[model samples]
Target: MYQYTDFDRHFVRQRAAQYRDQLERHLRGELGTDEFRALRLQNGWYIQRHAPMLRVAVPYGELSARQLRQLAHIARTYDRQPDGPFAGQGGYGHFTTRQNLQYNWIPLVDSATVMELLADVDMHGIQTSGNCIRNITSDAFAGIAPDEIVDPRPYAEILRQWSTLHPEFAHLPRKFKIAISGALEDRAAIGWHDIGLQLKRDDAGHIGFQVFVGGGMGRTPIPGIEISPFVAWDHILVFIEAVVRVYNLAGRRDNLYKARIKILVKAEGQKFVDAVNEEYRRILADDPAGHEQLIPQAELDRVKASFVDPAGVKAEPAVTLDDGDPAFARWLARNVHGHRLSGYRAVTLSLKRVGIAPGDMSADVMDTAAALAERFSHGELRVSHRQNLVLPWVREADLAELFQAARAAGFATPNAGLLTDQIACPGGDFCALANARSLPLAAEIAERYQDVDELVDLGEIDLHISGCINSCGHHHSGHIGILGVDKDGAEWYQLTLGGSDGSTLSGTTTPGKVIGPSFAADEIADAIEAVLNTYQRDRLSGERFIDAVKRLGLDPFKTAANAVRVSTAKAPA
Candidate 1:
């Protein structure tokens, strides 16, 4: 975890104060809606379909217990409960795919108060939204992953500081996202970000990055191209600056839809690479030795030192699990991940509990999770890109006790990588940009697949649902992807198969392909069941859903899904 320096604290506090003043002016009508819109967006305030949404940055998905406590407090103090059975409980904060926290019902007037609260914990909403470099994300298990070539947090922090309030790139043609992964497994979905950096080692044992540019999902889903095979660690910042500069200058501004760097890269192709290389050369020529080199030796040492492994921690020798409770065994199998340390294991606290919206947690649950993290994980926790909380340093010996505690706290749900552990964005219910509601559909799917035995039989599956083509839910990366769309006045869903976030560690990636025509929202679950049935029938021994789909193609699943739809339509009402 990167600690904020005195200067960093001072900067955030000052920015909060500035925003407070701006917000007050807007409320007083001194500033018009149009004038305040840009300022509010830059500060992470969005007027959604229902109420204003505030996205608080959780840099590199890391949070201290103290910071988590502050977030819990914010949820209780500022957010409002919806009208439902869950009402009267404190506001439920939504964890997003970007590893940030979103409160959907925050009042517009309290936006500055939220910023102040965040700044108190050395956090802020700066550059979290708007046409700026968004939160710099990395592998959730960056430092502790056994196969990681380098811990990406130090570099992510470097980029965070460099990109924060960058005047030249703040108002670019479109918003930008960057992800870095040191693990061979692309847990951070590096291929789908605007600029993805995968750490690699050379023959001389020098660390560099394999840079991918322009990969994104939306109306146009394209995997990033390898822009640079090997960029030295020291030159990464400069290289990124060069790439952004090229995009800033040449990316389209005429149409909002075509403004992203992906569009620019699509249009220019190899010429785009040439332009970036030329820019990189010019930047280096001008600043042979300057502050533009964000990661100097001293800075690297400082940042790395802050993230040192937990002191005096020892490995628990060869512990055996309690096989008496089948439920505990299931939770262990699904929620626990191997850690680099001998005794420690990374535990994912599933936010995908049935009946609850994916990634939504009430303030009380947040507090309980914080307490659990403090007690078990060295007072530190991480938010995964999959929209779940991670206790990165849980001891294997304590798994049973932790499981008990988690069950009481509503965090133990024996489904981490299963179909029920779906990733979905706040759709028409919350997001003004959405064409249809996604939470209800996700809930329906989760309810339909509550059978633990069935899920285990189904094997590992990545099911993602997005509200619209923006792909906020990362539908294009799921094994079974669902995208919500508007057809006439009805909400329809388009299904895709064989997409993955590269979790297989195979060093190759592919986006999902659409299976067939869109289905009505009501018919999606049955259609999904039909696809799964086809997969079960056609799959070779030991093949996963994605592997089976790829080997057998989408035709079989498509045929099965359509048959189900047709049969259901013809049934007597």
Candidate 2:
């Protein structure tokens, strides 16, 4: 994790102070509601269905244990529903797929205090919401992945600093997202981002990026086009700026649905590419500060130096554990992952337990996670894009002890990458944008697959659920995607088959095909079960769920899903 310097600390505090003044003005009615809306959104505040929701940025998914501890304190202290279904309860925080944390019940009046608390730990909500560059995300195993071509943290950090308060592209046509990947696999889901950067090396061993433009999911699901095969590391920032500038100038603003860069790219095709390239050419040739925009080797080195191994982390001899406990073996197989270093293993602490909303963490669990990071991972933690916590530097020698402690703390479910380890959003329960609920369905499915043997037999499946069309839950990229819909004022779910996030198992980044008409909320779980049954019945030996889906296509799954729909009609309340 990058340690915050005095400048970074001062910058965050200043932003927090400014937010306090703005919030005070808004509260006193000195600032109009319409005028305060943009200001609040810029500071990561939003008025949800019930109360204010604050999204705190976790830059590149990295967090020190101390920072996490402070987050737990905020959850315990400020995230409360004074008079609602959750009145007496507090201490809830959600981890989003974009690698940020959201507090749903935070009062708008107390938001400035929350901002100040975030600043105390070098964290804030800047650009987390609004039509600006959001958090810069990357692979959860960014620096530790064994198959990494280059460490992307330095480049991600550089992009973060460049885009943070960028005067030029802050107010684009829509919210812009950027993801980078340095590993052989596309764990970051970069192709689904507004700007996707895959760090690579040329034949001569010079680091550069394979830039993809205009990939996003919403009403339209499109994979990004490869705008450039390689943008040299020094010019990557300028190249991206050119792409954003082109979109900003040409992207639609009349219709909210068509305002995304993807729409612009899809509509213009080659013309979009031509315009971006022309802009890039002008930036390098015509602009006075073009040469100054090039990244210096010294600056790159300075950022890279901050990403070194956490202090006190040293290599230890690898040990083979032949534990007789099947549960322990299952946890090892599922949660533990390979690390670049010989003795270190990255372990995912499962957050998808039944009855609990996926990604929702209470203060107790947060504290336990912080303690686990300190004891096992050198006090460094990572928030995975899959909505789970990661101990990125855990020692292989401490596997058994850590697993035991984690299980005791409800973090060890041994279901990582399995059917029960689902990715879901806070749907109708909290989000005002959602048309239906996602948490109930996610919990029902998780409860149905509690049998560990059954979950393992089903194999690793990317089951994603979204409450609405926003794609915040990344439903379009799941092997099995469930999108909530409103049918005749009743909650319904649309099932999709054969989506891929471009992982080793999923092949490439592609949107899933819808499996006919939507099912009522009550029927969705059974419908999903039907699809899984079809896969189990027809799959070749050792074939993963995604592979079977690709081989058989969507017809079989569609038929199975539709077969489970109830014949009797239920009127909407």
Candidate 3:
């Protein structure tokens, strides 16, 4: 994790103070709602369907245990839903696919205080929302992954500092996202981002990036195209600036639907690439500060130095645990992962248990997680893009003890990549943009698939859900995608098969195809079960769900799903 310098600490505190002043003025009626909207959005505050929602940025998903403790304090003390469906039920935080944490019930009047608290811990929501470069995400197993080409944290941190409040690209046509993957596998889902950077080395052993541009999800789901095969690591910032500059100048502003850079890139095609190249050439030749912007060796070294392994961790002899206990064996296989270091193992603290909404960690759970991090992970923790907390530095010898503690803490479900480990968003219940609720449906599916044996037999499945077309839950990337829709004021869901997140398991980055017409909300779970049953019956030996879907096509699964879709009148309560 990058340690904040004195300047970095001061910057967030000053920004928090500025936000407080702006919030006070807005509350006092001195600032109009429309004017204050932009001000508040820049600081990551949004008025949702029921109340104010605050999204706190977690850069590259790294967090200190102290920071996690403070977050728990904030949730316990200030987060409460006073009205709507969730009135009196709060004090929990929701982790997002973007690796940010959201609080849906925070009062607007108390938001300034929350900002100040965040600043105290060198954290803030600056540039987390609105039409700007959002928080840069990377593979969760960045530094410790065995297949890593380079440590991407330093570059991701450098990008984070560069894009935060950049004068030129603060506001673009639409919200922009960038993801980097240093691993051989695309764990960060880089192909689905506006700018996807894959860290690589040349034949001469020099670092560079393979850049992809224009991918996104929504009404139109398109994978990004390779804009540049390899850009020198030192020139990444300048090249990215050129790409954004082209989009800022030419991207559509007429319709919100067509305002994204993806749309612009799609429309312009090779012309867009040509324009970006021209812009890159001009920046280096014509712009006064362009050459100066190229990262110097000393700056790179300074950033990389902070990413070194913690002082206490050492390379010890490798060992494995094989207790007679089946539960322990299951947890060891599913929740634990191999580490680059000899002795260390990465363990996922499951947040997908039944009863609680997926990724919603209560105050107690957060505090316990912080304690677990301190005790086992060198006081550092990581928030995975899949909305789970990871102890990235747990010693191999500590697996049994950690498992026992984690089980007591309610996060040791041993279903890390299983069918029950679903990804969902706070849908219509909280988000104003949602057409239907996602939590209930996710809960229903989770409740049905509790047996670990059953889940393992089903294999690793990415079942993602979204309330609307916004794709916050990344439903388009799921092997089993469920998208909530509206039908004459009733809730319906559209099922899509064969989506993937571009991992070793999910081979490619592609959108799932809808099987047929949408099903009533009540019939969606049955429809999903029917599809899964079809896969179990017809799949070849050792075939995964995604492979079967691809090999057999969507016809049989479509028939199975349609067979289970009942009429609105026939839907069970």
Candidate 4:
């Protein structure tokens, strides 16, 4: 596990103090509630339905056992320790869609204390949330993945250091999310980020990044434009700076809803990419040391050293996932992924347990997970881009028992990377930004596909839902995606198909129409069923629904949904 340096410690401590001062002044009637509310959000604080919520940034989804222990202490002391039916009656904590954690209830006064606690552990709330540089995510299996070209952890860490409270870039027009994945796997969902980078190696064995700029899902969704290619290791930061520069200068300022990098990329098109690249070339040409070729080998090496591989791990016999652990067997197949380490696999604890809101982990669960991290798996833990907690390096032998234990702790879900493993943002129920509560829509979908056998039979699918265009639910990347909006002062839902997160040139096909404002959860499922049935009849054996839908066109799905509505309406009325 990586330990914090003195420089890291000082930076967080100072940030905590600065926040403390700001909070005190706000409470003393110096700053208005509206002003303080915005400021507190920058530090990952949110006033949820029940109480104040504090989202703590777990950088790159990395957590040391000590850090986990400290998190447990915060849960136990400052908030209700929810383990039973009503323990966390009002609130506790929930890990989110991004790689972060949130304490659902904490006093404003306790905010400073929590900051001090995190700072003591060399953590900070700075840049984790709000309309600033958010948590930088990368391949959770960066080093461990067997097929990786190189470890992405070092590059991620370097970017983290450079972007944290950057002097000139702090206040952006909107939030920014940067993701990097090693050439091993698309674990970081590289296609659905503000800036997605993949570390690649050419025939010459020179390491560089394939940069994707402006891919995001919010009010509007678009695949990132490939503005540049084969960015040499030394020029990674410079290339990113160039991308940001283009966004800063050209991004929409008139409408808050239209201000994301994706929107900019969409409006600008290919000419924009070419223009930006030309501008970047000019900048580098004018001052090679000042721009593209300025990053030092020493700095890169210093970052590389911070990431030390897990020690004392040994390969052992594979656990019998099928024998006496059918529940775990399904889970292992869906959630566990191969690693670079010969004997290790990366496991995701499916927090999306049926009826409960996805990503909502209780405090007790967090503590238990922390304990489990220390005992069975490596002390390091990670959170996934898809709103799941990851035990990064579990040995093959411990798979079954780990799954059983995880089941007891509200995990053990086998629908990872499937339709039921849906992505939803905190909708109208909690978010001021949402038009409808996305969780209910997600729950409705989960209900429709509850049977594990049926879901498996359906095969691999990505179903993403967002309450609004902001796309917190990531509706843009789902093979079958749903978006909710308030039209004519009523909630209306839209469907889009053929969007994939792992493929080249991924984007939604023809957009679907606006459904009713009073659309029931069952209605969404009905529409999806119509789509699936069409695929079942049309598709060849073994073809995935996404592939089938792409082959036959989305009109079939549309016809099914429309037919269902007409039949149900005409017969009942």
TM-score of each: 0.97, 0.97, 0.97, 0.89
Each candidate's lDDT (Cα)?
Answer: 0.88, 0.90, 0.91, 0.75
What is the per-residue lDDT of model 4 for residues 1-573, given as tens digits with 9 covering 90 to 100? Answer: 456788788888988898899899998999999999878987888886656778898777777767877877787678753443327443345666677777765777789889989999887777876666788887666676777888888888888888887765776778899988886557677777889898899899999999988877665556676666789988887777777777777778788988888887887788678767876787688786664346788877877776766678756555544545677667767888887666678888777866677777655666778877876677878777778777877887777778778878777778887778878776776677677678777777787788999889888887788887877777777787888766556565677777777643233322223323224344666777887778778888898887787778767777777675633543211
- Clash number for each model: 0, 0, 0, 9
**Candidate 4: C-alpha lDDT:** 0.75
Worst 10 residues of 4 by lDDT: 509-518
Name the better of 1 and 2 by lDDT.
Answer: 2
Clash pairs (backbone) in predicted model 2: none
Residues 1-573, candidate 2: write the lDDT tens digits.
Answer: 777789999999999999899989988999999999999999999999988899999999999889999998998888885643334555678999999999988778889999999999999999999898999999999999999999899999999989999999888999999999999998999999999999999999999999999899998999999999999999998899899999888999999999999999999999999999999988888655655778989988888889999877878888888678998998999999999998899999998898788888887788889999999998999999999999999888899999999999889998988888888989998899998999889989988999999998999999999999997788999999999988868898888988888788788899999988888887899999999999999999999999999899989988888888776354222
Candidate 1 minimal-lDDT segment of 10 residues: 564-573
Best by the lDDT measure: 3
TM-score, candidate number 3: 0.97
Model 2 per-residue lDDT at 119: 96
